[model samples]
Target: MANSSQKKIAHENTKILLALRKGFIWVNAFYIFYRIIYQWNTFELKLALGYLVSAGISILLYTQINTMGKPRYNSKGELADAGEDLTQEGLVQYAFDIIYVTWFVHVTSAFWPKMWWFYLSIPLYAGWKVWQLVVKPMLSRSGAGAASDAASESTEGTKSRRREKMENRAEKGPQVRYR
Candidate 1:
């Protein structure tokens, strides 16, 4: 039952990640198109190349994520045991990050002369989004909790109780009743 619940949670995470990736790709593509249209006359080579590369990378990542195989589990039948796989979701995440940064640079460069501070401040918003969506979830799943260790220690009592309960169950052995 615990394994199934974990599996369900992993499945949900995968679905959410996939959806976020696809949504970001669509938004990136649209922004690139809009940039190209907006700068049709100006034609800044650096900005153009940035947009083109970002779009290409995003599309490739999307394809890879869609084609990547489902994650494997461990002896305990937990997806967390799988650690990290690189073929799909990981690559998509990396690609989307690149896309975001590239867009940030392009936009800032394009508007810097007219609105320097505003353009420079744009990345703060981008940084917040990246932290919330990408960094938080990835780190939480990876068990990188050194920063939160103190906070977690506050729950030591609850943890001890749960551990004690599990040990008691083991001592009692499996409750099996044959029909």
Candidate 2:
């Protein structure tokens, strides 16, 4: 009963987490698009770029931390040696930290702000995360990303070998007779 309840909690938490992630991505994308369209010629590249750079650095740090020092896969799709853990407990609790700081800065910039630039960092950061999570994974699956081509070839070779072995066994017929 306890195990069952634990599973239920985990399931609910996973659903909530997924919903939040999707909402964040969509909201950021739409917000960025609206701002870009609304600003058009009035866009402030300096502020946008600055915000983006700061957010990008935070994202990079967060990514490195979240990996928990796991070895990156090699060109053959094999895990490399274990590396040192860069962040303890994925510390810094990245998302809230970034949101709080950026939000504060954005609100304060109001006196001299290009409204679009203030919020631009979010979409840029979200877009990068999306690219990493979605686009890059798709590319790798399609054998387009780094190491994917070699990995796919190896996978194909493995499948063919498996098929041939199965076929060879089939030719020998069943060793046991069924009643």
Return the top candidate by TM-score.
Answer: 1
Q: What's the TM-score of each model vs. the native?
A: 0.37, 0.35
Reference-based lDDT, each prediction: 0.59, 0.54
* Candidate 2 local lDDT, 88-143, one digit each (tens): 23344445456445544544443345553555666787799789989988877776
Candidate 1 residues 1-179, lDDT tens each?
66675466457547755775767766665555555676567657765665566557656665565445345666796575322333345545665565555556555545452322343444686698799999999989667676568667877556677878999999999999999
What's model 1's overall lDDT? 0.59
RMSD of 1: 12.5
- In angstroms, give how far residue 160 of model 1 lies from its true place: 40
TM-score (C-alpha) between model 2 and the true structure: 0.35
